[model samples]
Target: MRLSFPKLAHLDIRRGLMMVLWLQVAIAAVMIAGDWLGRNPPGAPSSVPGMSDPVAPGDQRRRFDPDRPVPRRDAPALPPGIDLPSTYPDRLTFERKTIEGFGDVLLLNGSIATGDADRLSSYLDGASTEDLPATVALSSPGGQVIEALAIGRMLREAGKNTAILPGMACMSACPYILASGEQRRVSPEGYVGMHQHYYDENLYMPAYFAVEEIQRGQGRTMEYLIDMGVDPGVMIYSLTTPPEDIYILLPEELLDSRLATEMLD
Candidate 1:
């Protein structure tokens, strides 16, 4: 018969296992804390890990709405040859950015909110007195009625041409911007929509003044259409459509209504 060592107690074995488990849990918690601290080092400016700059409120372009603001989602898939610019300017208003490969062309993709005209003016001021962009590629869902008019007028005066490339949209007050273009073109895969301007729910203007202001804005737009060689009657589509809904004109309708000088095939 061989002598046997004393057997370990079950309670003692369980306690040892529990101690190991607790040690592992503590180690895991320390590791997690270390990773978090490394990512967000003390005294560093708060920022998204991957973003170059801090996100700004109302930074994204959106569909124009009298009652609410809806951010624009990424555009739908487009034809292979269409090139959308990737560069975004640092400003918060409607701005111009050079297309990466196309030096002469510029992208204006944003809402035409208040003070946007001033922003545009500053962009134009960067150019020589006689020289300006050859083309202004547009992708917008529109914004403040008066601001859009101001920006459009500036575009027209400068004789800048405009286009909505594939997978892009130009709607609401955007059509006014398009009209201001000396030569307006719409891609078959692009969209151009229109709707009436209603009283902005966020504003506190009197109802009578709101109505009068809208009428005045409409009249100015009609005159602008005439000046741009587009038919003033196109206002009919805008006047009848509710502000909340858009009337996307068909390719043929765009031509017939004179909203587009030509459709890119």
Candidate 2:
């Protein structure tokens, strides 16, 4: 006589099925909890232990709140201050501030707006009236790539060093300014990020033309990096990071990219 497996003791079969059902339920609960936490994550480090390299969505990330205005698609994951200027701030303004450890700095704050490049050039032209700051400190969410590039060239011409202290951010095209620095100093606590650049598309313009323009812009940027002594490889982060999220560079990446000559010890 042969014993069929399905005909085994009813009690034994029932117990095994119950155990599997409960295990599945427990797994579902854990996954649900993980997703909920991810919605409001405290942000993970750029380079986790045992990881080969630093990547996107790191310590600087925050939940995307619906209340915030999404400027360019390539804006930071964590929006800037509440009630702050989303578009161009009236204009990029400069203030003479004295920062600790770094001494006096010419603080450039607010969004980079149209004609801001001319404004910066004018500011430096009159810098002789007052004591010139050793460093040009940047704090902005970034705007107007063309303006940012122009400002960067002016900074490079001036031979000013750059620094970013904690409690402030330098992201997007702002890094171009940082790269222009004769010497770059950064505090790990300060946030520095990058993402793909966005250009306003004209309905009248053909797709191929738009693509060509973007390529030319990128080429100029790569050339600028080379001239600034920064590794063009750093653009890898900018290219890979999505427009919706910012890629916060780790201290190591900053050093490796030559974006920072030295960091807060």
Q: What's the number of clashes in each of the models? A: 0, 0
Tell me, by TM-score, which candidate is best: 2
Cα-based TM-score, every candidate = 0.62, 0.66
Q: Model 2: per-residue lDDT, tens digit, 132-168?
A: 7878887776667778888888888888899877645
lDDT tens digits, residues 1-265, model 1?
9776565444587788998999999886776666456433588542222111111332222233422222233435544444544532222233344543433455676666778789888878786753566677777776776677788788888878888777677777878888878888888667776777643533433344467766776777778788888888888778866554555667777788777889986
Candidates in order: C-alpha RMSD to true structure: 19.8, 16.5
lDDT of 2 at 265: 49
Please give the distance, in angstroms, between residue 108's alpha carbon in candidate 1 and its true position after superposition. Answer: 0.8
Cα lDDT, model 1, residue 242: 51
The regions of model 2 sitting more than 4 angstroms off are 1-90, 199-209
* Window of ten residues with lowest summed lDDT in model 1: 46-55
TM-score of 1: 0.62
Name every residue pair that clashes in candidate 1. Answer: none
lDDT (CA) per prediction: 0.65, 0.69
